[model samples]
Target: MTLVLKPLAEQVMVITGASSGIGLVAAKLAAARGAKVVLVARNDASLTEAVEAIRAAGGDAISAVADVGDIAAVRAAAAKAVGHYGRIDTWVNDAGSAIYAKLVDTPLDEHQRLFQTNYFGVVHGALTAIPYLRDTGGAIITVGSIASDLPSPILSAYAASKHAVKGFVDALRMELTADAVPIAITLIKPAGIDTPIAQHAANHVDGEALIPAPVYDPALVAEAILDAAEHVRRDITVGGAGRLQVLLGTHFPALLDRLAGVMIPAMSDKTRPKTESTTLFEPEQRGQERSGVQPGRKTSVYTAAERHPIALRSIALAGIAGATLLAFRRSRTRK
Candidate 1:
């Protein structure tokens, strides 16, 4: 059977973690593009506010307060969306939590709690959304991190959860393909997004928690997620830095490991005071979009790559050739 893909205006999208960060941004953008949006998050007040904002801006939106970590709650949320919108065309698994501490330093329960939201939340969202999507061809976009591809020092638990998400997404994609299901399953891996995540993360370190430098705006990630809803792609890494890290980690694991060891320690600011704020146990206040901490880069190479893949490939090849020639010249001079 030939698969039919619906346009954004004709689809109903349910976004988890819709109260803040990338999920919230994606929800707003998707609504602006004419999609009926079902906003899901644990925070009822923030979810209501987000829905009202969408409505005020002349968009169709409904709120379902549910913790993605709870399978039954997520299932109910899905039912509510279907009950309200009649059907769901796109499901975005964007709910996530993090911890900033060494593996040994992290409490076992805290680590488990991180998994509940980050990894299992995606599981719950996918499991709940898949049946509906299987009946009517739709999309499942899971928001992962660049950490899925490479490990960060302080975010060990969060990194592990993302890795698990990648594994689940890959396996599910294969299953759907084998079964001849027309669902479009995509994983969006973002790196150092300028979102409220850093401020919201549970910090165990001595200094302030901050997303690493060269952060990309959450809007970039939201745009990518919305694009994936219309297009069929297996996975997309958002920032150029993230793509480079994946490539290097894959090809030069040892070198990347050494670099990470040096870079992670240097990035921490000792002067900044630390605070413990875990969205793991309870819902935090919202209304803020960006973290307001990091001054993100003006342009994203990943966005350019997405727009011009061929041109980006050509540029990469040329750069590799130039570096090889330069190295050869240096070797000759040494001889």
Candidate 2:
């Protein structure tokens, strides 16, 4: 068995939204493991801080302040990574936003911005990485969500955006395989990690945030992401609940479709009333940045429903097993 591990010294990692949350944690882990990292995010200051922190910890890394919304900027960032490191081994499409509101309350450009980062940003990164990455069997990892797996009307746009990301990554994975490209694509689904994403969710005119979210730990997701990079698994679930949702949704597709309508509303305790706006990452509010890792929370475990893996094998197995058991029981009764 030939196990080809990504060489930490030669492997260069490019991460989006490295200024915070899972991206930040993932950067730390990669650096600790001896990979040269390139940090990309809108906040140049925060990106600098992350780079310095990593360097202080005896890790090699660089920072690029770029927004995923701009293809030129994304491409430039990718170029910059290769320039510094001479080669890029892994590229992660993690720049995304959840700032959303009711469909009726959504802005005309809401979907545009979502795709700018969520879908198009990934496309841009993938395109940028292709030329330089083709020879290295590089990996593309995108942080997806449970919302993508199971769409909900309340956050339809966010879910839709994620669904699009899933589609792109899935198709790209196969295309790369069929073409015999060494690059591996992985779609990472995270149920919820208590990142400041909710704080950054777009708000309406009434001070009410545009989207609501649940909490999940960022570190666990970071670990899972690194694991994916190492193993090149097609996809991974970041939470237990996420895993369950993928499982139940597959085994009982119709039932899940029906249940989602009844279940999605429970994700948030409150919804927007009137045109009020809410806090989302602008700071001085619920969206304040997390400076250091919190104590005792390095292990935020998710329920089965939250880790909605993009890979459907487990869900398929469960469906097949259930069907077989049901058929056996019916045959026995008839006999």
Candidate 3:
């Protein structure tokens, strides 16, 4: 079935993990664009602050405090959205957590908790949103990671959970399509984004956790989410660097295996103290986008090209033709 998504201005969006990071950024952006937003997260204070801030900025938004891992809570959050807005046009599953440790060193509980949030949380969000979305012909956007395809040595459990997420989303999309459900299912595979996830991670690493080099701004991901909400996309990797890593992992698994030693050390920052904070089990801090570890790029050319492929290709071909003509003129002049 062809899914026709409504314009952002005419939609009611429910975003999980909306207290901070990419989720929070997307909530604000959606509201700013005239979507009535329902922000869901475990942090009550952060949700309140985010909702108040959005309202203060002349946007319509409300907060629903619920852990995405809990299906009942997620359902209640969805009900709250429908109660407030009368219908749900888009549901974003952006709630996730991470653990920084080797698979062996990672505790079973922590690994389970990571899956609960990162994997099952997405499952919960999709299942909860599907019924309401069916009535409105809406979209379900899940924030996956490049790690969904590429495994990280130190972040084994997080990678595993994302892998599960990718599988679930793929199968669900196909099943829904076969069933003739009109809801759009999109997976957003982002690269290392500068968000508080590192600070909020359950770190078993020796030093402070970092998202590694080539991190991107959370706004880039937020843009991708909103784009999927308005337009149908199968999946989008936010950063070119991340897309490259996924390609490498796909085509040259042995090369990545060989480079593991080099990649392992890059995941931590010894200069800073090991993080004593963690959001794996509970909420720590909220209402911030960037983690301040690095200044991420303001834009991603890869993502821009992905979102507007034909337009970008037109520009690229025009530039190539112009460069060729210039080179021809230069050769003639020299002759």
How accurate locally is residue 58 in candidate 2, as Cα lDDT from 0 to 100? 100
Write down the lDDT of every candidate, Cα atoms only: 0.87, 0.71, 0.91
Q: By descending TM-score, how would the candidates be arranged? A: 3, 1, 2
Instruction: Give me the displacement of residue 70 in model 3, in angstroms.
Output: 0.7
Which of the two candidates, 2 or 3, achieves a greater TM-score against the reference? 3
Scored by Cα lDDT, where does model 3 land?
0.91
Model 1 regions lying over 4 Å from their true place: 307-335
In the range 117-138, model 2's lDDT, one tens digit per residue, is: 7888888888888888786677
Candidate 2 or 3, higher lDDT?
3
Off by over 4 Å in 2: 1-5, 205-214, 250-335
Note each model's CA RMSD in angstroms.
2.6, 5.3, 3.3
Question: Whose lDDT is greatest here?
Answer: 3
lDDT tens per residue, model 1, 1-335: 65666899999999999999999999999999999999999999998999999999999999999998899999999999999989999999999888888899999998998999999999999999999988779999999998898887888789999999999999999999999999999999998898888778888887778887668888888888988888787788889887887788899988977887776664456688865666777996564568787866647866667645687788889999999999999999999
Name the weakest run of 10 consecutive residues (lDDT summed) in model 1.
261-270
Best-first order by lDDT = 3, 1, 2
Spell out the clash pairs found in candidate 3.
Answer: none
TM-score of each: 0.92, 0.78, 0.93
The weakest ten consecutive residues by lDDT in model 2 span 279-288
